[model samples]
Target: MTARVGVVTFPGTLDDRDTQRAVRTAGLEAVPLWHRDKDLKQVDAVILPGGFSYGDYLRAGAISRFSPVMETVIAQAKAGMPVLGICNGFQVLTETHLLPGAMLRNNHLHFICRDQKLRVENAETAWTRSYEQGQEINIPLKNIDGRYVADERVLDELEAEGRVVFRYEELNPNGSLRDIAGISNAEGNVVGLMPHPEHAVEPLIGTGRTDGLGFFTSILKRLVSA
Candidate 1:
């Protein structure tokens, strides 16, 4: 059977359709999951795409953390399901404590958007297994609250466990701590990043480069093999 990847949509979310397209582009079935829905529709994996959920009110992803869909996503992720969170979705992961870290306003306090270069710090995660460790790729990044922050101890722990999946290369667009761009759970099943990989998956869309396609393809390969 073809692997089904769920793309969740919350009110104010602006990237669900693009994310679903990215999933379908990877030869996987794209399943639409609504914020108000409690069922996952039995997807093999899930993606929380980028966008200004709840208009970033209260916090970028703070309000969406309590949405009905996240309750099951949180549990399934903890049970070893692959979950990828991008941009505002990354904020939601932090808000739900699914990933360790907090996203704050950019140090410059400005919304940053551009093609970002990232080094794959770890490639064993479900969402990044197709990339090589230390490999560099360019992905589109856009956000106001993109600065990733975590306590020193937690940062050290993540580093010690090889959970830092991606790191900013060349330029730190949002002043993320240690130039961290993305991280994964200890089990490597849950990953989150401030960059919008979905935006970079297709050529002629953002930068005419498909460097971000590996993310969607990586998870599809993992699910198919499983």
Candidate 2:
């Protein structure tokens, strides 16, 4: 059967369509999931795309974390379903406690939008299997509160367990602690990142680079093999 990947759209989400397009580009079915809906439509995977969900009020993803759809997503994610959260979506993952750490305002207190270079620190995660370890790729990053922070112990644990999946290369855009751009759960089924991979999936858009396509392709490969 063709793998189906669901893209969740919350009240203020803006990248659900782009995420669906990326799924299709990766030869998978794109399933639309509404924040108010509890059903997942049996999608093989789920993506919480970037955007100012709930207007990013009271912290970026705090409100969206309580959405009905997320109720089921949280359950499924813990049960080993593959979950990928991008940008604002990453904030939601952190809010929901599906991923470690928290996102704070950009250290410079500025909204940054740029193509960021990242190194694949842990390619064994469910969302990064397509990239080789240590490989470098450029993807667009845009957000006001994108800095990732955690206690020293948690940061050390993430690194020690090889859960820090992606790290900023050369230049850290948002001043995220340890230059962490992305991370995965211990089970490797849940991954979150601050960059907008969906925006970089196509070669004709957003810096004209296709480096982000690997993220979509990586999930498809995982679902297909399962």
Candidate 3:
């Protein structure tokens, strides 16, 4: 059976369509999930696309954390379902406690928009299995509240567990703690990052690079082989 990947659309989300397109391009069915719906349509995996969810009010992903869909998502994720959160979606993962750390304002206190360089620190996650460890890729990252922070102990734990999946390579764009750009849960099923991978999936579009397609294909490959 073809892998069915769900792309969630919260209110004010800007990249849901892009995520769907990327999923389709990767040969998976793109199931559009709504914030108000509790059902997941039996998708094999879920992607929380990047966008200004809930208008980023009360902080990014803060308001969206309470959406009805999240209740199911949190439970499903804990049950070993693969979940990938991008940008503001990353913020939601943190708010929902599915992942560690919090996103604060950029150290520069400015909205940054650019093609970011990130080194793949861990390529064993469900969403990154197609990448080689230490592979460098450029993806679009545009956000205001993008700084990642956590207590010393939590940071130490993440580092010690090899949970830090991605790190800024050349320059840290938002001063994220430890130059961390992405992380995965202990099971490697839940992954969250502050970059717009969907936007980088198409080659004829912006940077003409298809490095982000690995994320989508990785999940599909995992589901098929399992």
Candidate 4:
């Protein structure tokens, strides 16, 4: 059977459509999931795309973590379902405590947007299996609160466990701790990252680089093989 992936759309989410396109491009059926709905529609995996949920009012993803859809995402993710969160979605995962650490305002105190280079630190995660360990690739990044921070103990634990899945290659655009750009859960079923892989999936669309296609394709292979 063909794998079906769900792209969630929260109230202010802006990348759901682009994420769906990336899903379909990876040869998987793209399912639309709503923030107010509690059902997952039996999708093999789920993706929480980027945007300012709830206008980034109280905090990025702070309010969105209470959305109905997230309840299900949290439960299923604990049950071993694959979940990938990008940008603001990454903020949600942190707010939900599914992933360790939290995002802070850019060290420069300004929203930054650009093509970013990242080194694949852990290629075995559900969303990064298609990449090679230590592979350097460029993905488009855009965000205001993109700096990732955690306590010293938590950061050390993540590093020791090999959960730091992606790291900034050459530049630390947001001044994230340890230059960490992405991380995965210990089980490798959940991943959160500040960069927008969906934005870099199409060669003709952005900077003519499809380096981010691995995120979608990696999950496809994971679900199909299972």
Candidate 5:
């Protein structure tokens, strides 16, 4: 069966369509899921595309955490469903407690937008298996509140468990804790990152680099083989 990947569209979401396109480009059916809908449409994997969900009011992704769809997503994710959160989506994952740490304002206190270099630190996650560990890739990152913060103990735990999936290389754009650009859960089914991988999937776009396509392809491979 062809894998059906769901791209969630929350209010104010700007990249759901791009995420869907990337999924289709990766040879998977792209299913559109709504924030008010409790059902997942039985997708094999879910992608929370980046945007100013809930207008980024009260904090980035703070209000959107209570959306009906997220309630189901949180449960399904805990049950080992594959979930990939990008940019503001990453903020939601942290707010929902699906991932560790919180996102704060960038150290520079400015919204930074650019093509960023990141090293694949742990390619064992469902969303990163297509990449080799230590492989470097360039992806676009645009956000204001993108700094990842966690207590010392939790940071150490993440390091010890090898859950740090992506690390900023060359220059840390937001001064995220330990230069962390992405991380995964212990089971490697849930992954969250601040970079906009969907934006980098098409070669004709921004940087003309398709390095981000691997994220969608990785999950398709996992779902089909399973």
Candidate 6:
């Protein structure tokens, strides 16, 4: 059976359609999941796409943490479901304590939009398996609050555990600590990143590079093999 991946749409979400297109391009079924709905529709994996959830009011993702859908997502994620959070979705993941660290405003205090270079520091996670360790990829990144911050000890622990999945290469746009662009949970089932991989999945879009297709393909491979 073809794997089904859920792309969630919160009230202020803006990338659900692009994410769904990416999933379909990777040969998976893209299931639209509503923030107000409790059911997951039996999706094999879940993706929280980039967007200003709840208009990023009260801080990005602070309010979306309490959404009803998150209850099921949190439970399923804890039970080993693969969950990928992008941009604003990453903010929500941190707020829900599914991932450590907080996203602060850009160091320059301005929204940035560009094709970003990132090194695949750890490719063993469910969402990054298609990449080779240390490989570099270019994906589009756009956001105002994109700086990732964490306590020193927590950062050390993540580094020690090989959970820093992606690191900014060459250019650190938001002054994220240690150039950290993304990280995965200890179990490797949950991943949250600032770049919008879905935007780079098609050759005709963005930089005309499909480097981000690996993320979608990675999850599809895992689901198929399981």
TM-scores, one per candidate: 0.98, 0.99, 0.99, 0.99, 0.99, 0.99
Across residues 97-185, which tens digit of lDDT does each residue of candidate 4 receive? Answer: 99999999999998888989999999999999999999999989999999999999999999999999999988999889999999999
Model 3: per-residue lDDT, tens digit, 102-143?
A: 999999999989999999999999999999999999999899
lDDT of 5 by residue, 113-210 (tens): 89999999998899998999999999999999999999999999999999999999999999899999999999999999999889888889966999
lDDT of 2 at 192: 97
lDDT-best of 4 and 6 = 6
lDDT of each: 0.93, 0.94, 0.94, 0.94, 0.94, 0.95
- lDDT for 200 (candidate 6): 89
Off by over 4 Å in 5: none
lDDT of 3: 0.94
Deviation of model 1 at 223, angstroms: 0.5
Candidate 2: tens digits of C-alpha lDDT, residues 103-203: 99998999999999999998898899999999999999999998999999999999999999999998888889999999999999999999988988888
- Model 2 stretches astray by more than 4 angstroms: none
Misplaced by over 4 Å in model 1 are none
Candidate 1 vs. true structure, TM-score: 0.98
Candidate 6 per-residue lDDT over residues 1-226, each given as its tens digit: 8999999999999999999999999999999999999899999899998999999999999998899999999999999999999999999999999999999999999999999999999989999999999998999999999999999999999999999999999999999999999998989999999999999888888979999999999999999998
Please give the distance, in angstroms, between residue 111's alpha carbon in candidate 6 and its true position after superposition.
0.4
lDDT of 4 at 209: 93
Positional deviation of residue 153's Cα in model 3 after best superposition, in angstroms: 0.7
Q: Pull out the clashing pairs in model 6.
A: none
Q: Which ten residues in a row have the lowest lDDT in candidate 5?
A: 198-207
Report the alpha-carbon TM-score of model 6 versus the true structure.
Answer: 0.99
Cα RMSD, model 1: 0.7
Q: Which 10 consecutive residues of model 6 have the lowest summed lDDT? A: 198-207
RMSD, every candidate, angstroms: 0.7, 0.7, 0.7, 0.6, 0.6, 0.5
Best by lDDT: 6
